[model samples]
Target chain A: MNETIQHLLNHRSIRKFKPHQLDQETIEILVRSAQAASTSSYQQAYAIVGVEEENLKQQLVEVASGQTYVADNSYFFVFCIDYHKHVLAAELASGSVDQTVETTEALIVGAVDAGLAAQNLVVAAESLGYGTVYIGSLRNDAAKVSELLELPSHVVPLFGVAVGIPDQQPGKKPRLPMDAVFHRNTYTDDDTMRQLLSQYEKETSSYYGERTDGRRTEGWVNQMAASMKDPKRTYLRHFLQEKHLSRD
Target chain B: MNETIQHLLNHRSIRKFKPHQLDQETIEILVRSAQAASTSSYQQAYAIVGVEEENLKQQLVEVASGQTYVADNSYFFVFCIDYHKHVLAAELASGSVDQTVETTEALIVGAVDAGLAAQNLVVAAESLGYGTVYIGSLRNDAAKVSELLELPSHVVPLFGVAVGIPDQQPGKKPRLPMDAVFHRNTYTDDDTMRQLLSQYEKETSSYYGERTDGRRTEGWVNQMAASMKDPKRTYLRHFLQEKHLSRD
Candidate 1:
């Protein structure tokens, strides 16, 4: 396999980082790497804000539900789903586009664009000897992150990713069985999901030795169980509607 | 500065592919590379259906708004925003432990997860000497696509990508200036956007060389206008409701 393929096959997320700060040149390389990612129809329906301020990172930490690594990281960024540019771009064509670009489809496009770009940035950072961790909990409170990032209406903060040099390496997180996902021409599996997850649960439960913290023994199934609990997304629809996204 | 960066920078959606078939090992490598992508919470919240049957490919061509190359490509994979597993996982967890998953967040997570993984697959494919094109119009009638794919509720079709050896090489598709999407610490530069896009709009406008298809002159602005004017999105909410995404 080629280097990029090899990198993709061997994947891991590094949450712990060293105190070393990323230089401006390195930041430029990452941003350029991000920009090189494919956008749907070149609409470029996303934007990112480099977080270099200590106070701002603190506020982001609070907004992201106390993921303190966000504040402690050497380099941080917030990726956004933006349609305001198209609204402005369309303004030059005729009038303000009437349709709300906040449909599930639109959100999917923006989120995917951001997601695709963020992955490219991840590999690029790793290539340069930097560590990375994606912050999906940033979506736990959309409005606060938007306000903290000074995001304009019609541009929502999808997620943030903290980047820095490695201080500690997190072991590879276990995944479900390959057959559970990789269907041939159609999606079919005779094996039960419980069986697949059961094997993973056993593997993960003892994978890491016990820590004082409760997260250690929780294992993969327990983690999935925890994720299943409602996060009170009432703020989400309200935020999207207030931001003028949703259906007309 | 590196060959990978150079390859990334030269990305273009290729519609025409040579009739050569990709080996099963290559498909495994590509999917493995895809699985290696960063998934939110490692939920792996997506599914890909590889298309090999000519009859199924023909139906997909129709679902993708009659893109003939979709059926003609060497490898066709449909990416999905799959929350069915989460729902099932939730059902099991809730029955055993009394918990429920957040549907909207799961949907968003699935799309972003699938999109990121698919992008990695694209890069890996290109690196392995293959051409690719994303079929976004698959959302034209999502319900139809779902029915055709035997997709359960909570599994939305995000997009399809066709991959193969290049029968034709295409030039890079233009993109908006970095300033248009990259903000410093926060989003604040309409002026910066206006300046950069003005030049980019010109580049994209001449992209097709001013052909007779009146749309050839629409440029980015015109395309946005035309998209906004799309009445096909007329019953999008009702469609999602029927699909049980019920974002309402």
Candidate 2:
């Protein structure tokens, strides 16, 4: 990995922010650089709402499930996967169009497009000496977010990104062993899975200073449990369906 | 956009492929570069499977609804929105886990994770002088692809990508005006839509070239109409549901 890939590999979510503000020029440059990232089908099926207003930012924090970083950050942006424009395009081309994707796939794609763009934006920002974090919690209540942002019917909040000058230096997070992620022709859940993860967990726990200091670090599994076992897991689909996405 | 972003900006599906073979080294480099992309929380929630064995590639071609590029190309890879490893991790943590996302937000993250990773792979391959096209048609029969790839339940085939040296330079595809995608505080899909797109369609049609042009050409709207009207256009959600996706 050279500098660019190295930068990506060594990325960390920096939540600590100084009270400094990002200038308009810098914001424009970052978004344009983000705009430069690849979009599927040139459908350009995505949008970025730069959160600026104080009350709106507070509402955004609520939309993001009260993640303080979102409201207080110097540079905050919500990346949305959008098909409203495509709907218009569809209508223009062929009167009324059947929405084949429903809201599921459409909303998923919107979030994905935005996430991909945000990833690129983060890398670019980091290259230019900014700290960043991806706020996936922004989707806790998509309908509310849509209302807050006055989003159109075909748009859904994918995630939020916070960027600014670093307030602190947090080390990079450790990844699982390559085999865990990089698999052969199929998926495997072998006993070797846990063994492969053993070294990674140790490395990760050690990096987090949880190895020597007995902390509740169950490693990847624990994190997965915290994340996946929530009742709200499938909530976005309903919200998406509510928004007329049948991603069928 | 410059040449690099221009290549990204004008991306399209090149279904026809010349009988060819990509050397193992280039293939390795491409996949490795893909692996080098930033993974969320360093979880690396995606995988790239090379369809090298001709029989397997043939099956994938059929699986992609007769998109010949899969079997005929120098290369093909299925990008997956995978949470299988994490699911296993959750099981290990709590001694049991659900096969489906308990939350719609988790689904959103997994989907976006794959997209972010795939876009990186695309950019990396393009930088290495490879021509590429995305195979969303693969999603036309995601379940068939899942069975063909012998994919485990939680890992879904979000899309496929085909890459090779270009036999022909596909023309640039225009995007909606920047304002169309970049909403300031909110989104607007109203009267301004028709007025702006009126002339742009002419530009899009011109780019498709004259009717005598050897290549099949359809303007975006017409292309979308064909896609929406195509029987395959509507099967994805059914495939997902039949695959036992529990979007509670």
Best prediction by DockQ: 1
User: Compared with the true structure, what per-residue lDDT tens digits does model 1 show for residues A70-183?
Assistant: 988779989988888877776777666546476655666778888878887877777666778889888888888888778877898878889987788667766666756666
TM-score: model 2, chain A: 0.88
TM-score of each: 0.91, 0.85
| Per-prediction tally of clashes | 0, 18
Write out fnat for all predictions, comma-separated.
0.49, 0.43
| lDDT of candidate 2 over A1-248, digit per residue (tens) | 34444454556678888887888877776776677665655556788888888888898887766778887778888888776666677778765444544635555556667866776677567777788888777766777778888987767777788897778887656656656665555555557666676666666666655644766555666665675564454666667776666545
Question: Which pairs clash (backbone N, Cα, C closer than 3 Å) in model 1?
Answer: none
Best by TM-score: 1
Model 2 misplacement above 4 A: A18-42, A101-108, A210-212, B1-44, B65-68, B72-75, B99-103, B210-222, B229-233, B242-246
- Which lDDT tens digits does candidate 1 get at residues B164-214? 888887776666666777777788667766666677778778875555455
TM-score of chain B of 2: 0.81
| Model 2 CA lDDT for position B92 | 66
Tens digits of per-residue lDDT for model 2 on B1-248? 23443444445545555667778766655565566555554556676666667777787777667877777677888888666666667766654446445345556666777776677666656655566777766766677778777777667788777887667765445655556666666665567755566556666666776643737555666665555443244554555555444355
Error of 1 at B225 (Å): 2.5
